[model samples]
Target: MKNLPLSINTLSKIIGKNCIYVDKTKMAYQLICQPGAFFLSRPRRFGKSLFIDTLKEIFEGNQELFKGLYIHDKWDWSQKFPVIKIDFSDGTLKNSERLDKRIYEILYDNADNLQIKLNLNRDIPGTFGELIRLSDKKYGNKTVVLVDEYDKPILDNIENSKVAAEMREGLKNLYSVLKGQDAHLQFVFMTGVTKFSKVSLFSGVNQLTDITLNTQYSTICGYTHGDMERQFSEHLDNVQWEKLKYWYNGYKWLGNTNVYNPYDILLFIHNRMLYRNYWFETGNPTFLVKLFQKNRYFLPSLENLVVTEEIIDSFDIEKINPLTLLFQSGYLTVEKTFTRRQRLMFQLKIPNFEVKIALHDHFINAYTDLVNEKIGLQDNLYDCLEQGDVRGMVQVIKRLFASIPWRNFTNNDLADYEGYYASVLYAFFSSLDAEIIPEDITNHGQADMTVKLANHVYVMEIKVVDNANIDDINGDDVNVIQHNNSALKQIQAKGYAEKYRGIKGITVHEVGLVFSTTLKNLLNQ
Candidate 1:
């Protein structure tokens, strides 16, 4: 115990963030093993702070604590420095007016810790550069800087629209002070959740060496497969390691893929709990809400997704793209990736249970596509469809669409309004746990939808009715009749019937759903 070092506090599950603190002997001495000012961007609660603390212990020359760790032998233990760690997360300034004061507070705290005398009074020296000079003179060593959560304020106000812009500009100026004082700064490492513009922080002295994408450092901030095995081996079963991998792992950076979310995973094992949607409960996105305002239905994009590589890799936050939103927010991950011209060209998907349901809920709350009558619309629709009454289905569907909150279904936001109706109906039936596959690819063509009930399989197609003036082409029109006939023909032509060829006493029916506000209308003969 005498040689163990005070690791108890750092090892606690709840407070220490259930972080295994995967010993990074290689990264512990970034100065010797690597070069340049370091920066890392990981999703929220992914162990950025713990990594920063490890840096503090290593660089402050606390060698006894790191025995058997990565840098214990490689680092010169006796080299101590005037460590001035200023975390941007604590900054409380309203704007640029208090930037100098915040920097001074950081200086005062560091000076007090090192027992260094410094004339920090406004009368003697008030600016950040002045405090740095006094702190250096008080202690004969260079300063090692660590900045954490450097983008919190900007993210917090990102939704206000007006204040968000002002906050960004303010942070830009405050961080600009680091330019001239580069000489006094011995080693600097910054950790934050997102990568905002470096023009704001680096301010042209020495560029931020964005190790966020560098393969060597990609696993530096977040835990890798090996990190999981080595440190938390005791909790392997606790983490449901294999299941955990299915959910939180798949993030790719630089050339390498496969990393885990330390936050959700650690908390999962620490609490020893199994539940639904833990990560989404941690933080809500105002940007996502704003995006929903623009893309109300998300009908087309979500329904027919065929992502190209450029959209996946170059996605930006402000644009409010859903695929990019899911990727960065830790909902979806790159299952596979390809490269062309030395750049990543494509990536596949694999969704975890945590994300699959949240996205479904996101769709529901973000858009009011449902007709909202609550008038037993389901009871009526189900009764009509079950009876195979084509005329009855058409009348009911027309009434339902007329009740639709048409204002919610706007232009590009809803590329396929007909698809929206299908999804809503699917959701209504989903609670019953009936197998519902929309536009199921068939040998013939995409079947609009196929609901497999206890005894029967119903194939249905839906179309939109924009105005009542097109009444002559009502649900009884031949096109409606011919469409259902053609569907039946194709269903038979492509051997959709052959595949299910001959099962024990099974019935197949073709149904046409003409969606409108008049009634829930369907046609079958």
Candidate 2:
């Protein structure tokens, strides 16, 4: 209940900033025991930077920050160690020589602080090994090395293979410096969003414990339930709890740990708004748009996906493999992991809703044809729900998908495309969520679309029009509406509409759309 202070160096000083110094009293303990070398991987903005900052304070022996906090009285903060923090959050490797220059600059900067100006020329290894040997003369204690965002280079050019590989190699060279300096390094902690093979960076640096999967340190990166309960309980009512969960609570750490996104959670509680995809824009993002497009991924039912290891284990950067990357990076998490016997097997669900629609806005961009419709999807569907117009709602979707550039999708892919379109619609109907079944089974068998909002259920039949599905149907049935008698019969025989029989108000609408056509063409047909 005590107030936080505002000093930059003192954790206590971070007052009025929603500062959460989760009694890392245990950090002091951890430092005493496993103080040798450590590495952590979590998604960006999950508090890796803040963790390092806190360590800097602790190691500096700033007892002021610890006042009344767990480490204050418990620690023998009597000794402050010399710290050398290397932040890779901004540095990059574009050219071979430039990377070396950046490496030399980092070494030179740290060395200059100790007043040891040496000639950092071409011949020096410039590895962490060489730097530590040079710094040992000036500082009494072994250095505490903190490298943040260590994978920025690799992330930057995931789309550009040549550049990504170049960056990877350069970073590998720079990290090579860390090897063999174990003698001079008292503590080493590196943080990244990836758990990349150590062979990529530290080939010789083994025995570096990966604390990422370690449940004990799970709260070390993001806000835990207890942290929120203890620190943010009062602010809970400020925003819709369901919306909060829908947007940010999907990430899981350890086995059972449910963690909230520190970035979104803080901004949400801090600003008190339920806005869309905020963090994605602020950072350098290549986006999962292409990935979604390639996988023919739907925006609505992504949350319900139970991914196989084949689907989730690996992905290419340009592909935006959301399953792999999101889970690996933290946007999506192991909501549940199924195992057989004692061996690890497959399948994962979206840990929660916070990340369900992370790809929504990204999809809009990827589908080039979908830009300019800034409709948050959540808003429009809810608008129709409030009006209780089942027919109008179906018409809205009919018109929505009808406007897309369908050339990108084939006839068979129409249902899949419409699934995403409906999912977007579902997102808008946030308030009436329980009613809408994304891939609902209706009287027609499986309705390509069935939306139940505001106690009204609508059964929809969507057929894709192209040279293939439509032209042939036109030839067979001669019906202007559904094409062939076969098409109409299939809809009737399957009983796709039967499922919606008693759901309050029921409406049936059949719509056939040509997505790639222009507005003029769409309006005419």
Question: In terms of TM-score, which candidate is strongest?
Answer: 2
Per-residue C-alpha lDDT of model 2 across residues 1-525, encoded as one tens digit per residue: 432221222343463354555565575457544457887878877767777777877777877766667666776787666677777676556665766577677767876765666665544354455557656656676777778787776776666767766776777766666666777777878888875555555565565777775667766766666676787776664556666666667566556767776676667665656566555445543444555555765655653556565454444443446567766665566656666665554445555444444444445445536556545433565576556654355456545555556664555454434454454444444323434555665433575555665555555444333333334312323354343433344556687666556655655433333332222122111
Structural similarity to truth (TM-score) of each candidate: 0.70, 0.76
lDDT of 1: 0.57
- By summed lDDT, the worst window of 10 consecutive residues in model 1 runs over 1-10
Summarize candidate 1's per-residue lDDT along 1-525 as a digit string, tens digits.
011111222322322343335665586566434434676766676667767777777767777667666787788777776666767665444554464456567767777787766664552133455555655666666666777877676666656645555666655654555666666666677776665543444454355576765666656756778876776676664456677776566666645647666665666665664645666667775466446545543332343344564454333224435565555555555555556667765454434556554554444444445535433655676675566554565566555555656565544434245656666556444423345666667766776777666666677665655433344434366565565444455555655544453578666666655443333322222
Residue 265, model 2: Cα distance from true site in angstroms: 3.6
TM-score of 1: 0.70
Q: Name model 2 segments beyond 4 Å from true.
A: 1-20, 25-28, 78-80, 91-96, 115-119, 122-127, 134-141, 199-206, 233-248, 272-277, 284-286, 295-301, 307-320, 345-358, 374-394, 405-525
In terms of lDDT, model 2 sits at 0.58
Superposition-based RMSD of candidate 2 using all C-alpha atoms, in angstroms: 5.4
Give the winner by lDDT. Answer: 2
